[model samples]
Target: MSDNPGPDSDPVRLTAWVHGRVQGVGFRWWTRARALELGLVGSATNHADGRVLIVAEGRRADCDNLLALLDRGRSPGHVDTVVAQWGPARGDLTGFVER
Candidate 1:
């Protein structure tokens, strides 16, 4: 089987800064689990400034779905806003991890 994707399959990378009640509220854990379920690869890190930085790489639509989840945030962690940047996938990540 070819590892290469077909022309119709557009991969993407999403760098998102999640704000509001994200720190120590299971945000990273939820992100890691959800990302893996979506067959994504990347990492989620907690910033000292009370923000969660998530880098997700996957199919364009999957990445978008992940972002939507972040927008709603999770229970116990009310998400105020999600600042995201999207681009072509780099294919450098192996699996989703929380940091």
Candidate 2:
């Protein structure tokens, strides 16, 4: 196996809006934990409209996994819908944080 992914492979950034019952429910904390576990770096915060805005940068597959996890919900909240916006990874974030 090679040590690098190759020229065609690149890090990915996700701007996801997790909607429905996501505020004031420790979802940000849970999201941070999950992102850290996936070795991703970015931030998660709650909007005043009851949606969680999560910006995560990492491997595409890992971000996908995180999306799947987010869609299924964790606890104290129900994830009704997930709006995903994918793009080139910024690679600027340090660690998972709450913003």
| Model number with the top TM-score | 2
Reference-based lDDT, residue 56, model 1: 94
Task: In model 1, state the lDDT of residue 98.
Answer: 90
How many pairs of residues in model 2 come into backbone collision? 0
**lDDT (C-alpha, whole model) for all candidates:** 0.88, 0.89
51 in model 1: Cα distance from truth in Å?
A: 0.5
* Candidate 1, 9-71: lDDT as tens digits: 788899999889987878889899889999999999999999889999988889988998889
lDDT of 2 by residue, 1-99 (tens): 999878436898999999899888888999999999999999998888889999999888899989999997664589999999999997788989997
Alpha carbon lDDT at 82, candidate 1: 91
Give all TM-scores, in the order shown: 0.88, 0.89
Query: What value does the lDDT take at residue 94 in candidate 2?
Result: 97
* lDDT of candidate 2 at residue 52, scale 0 to 100: 91
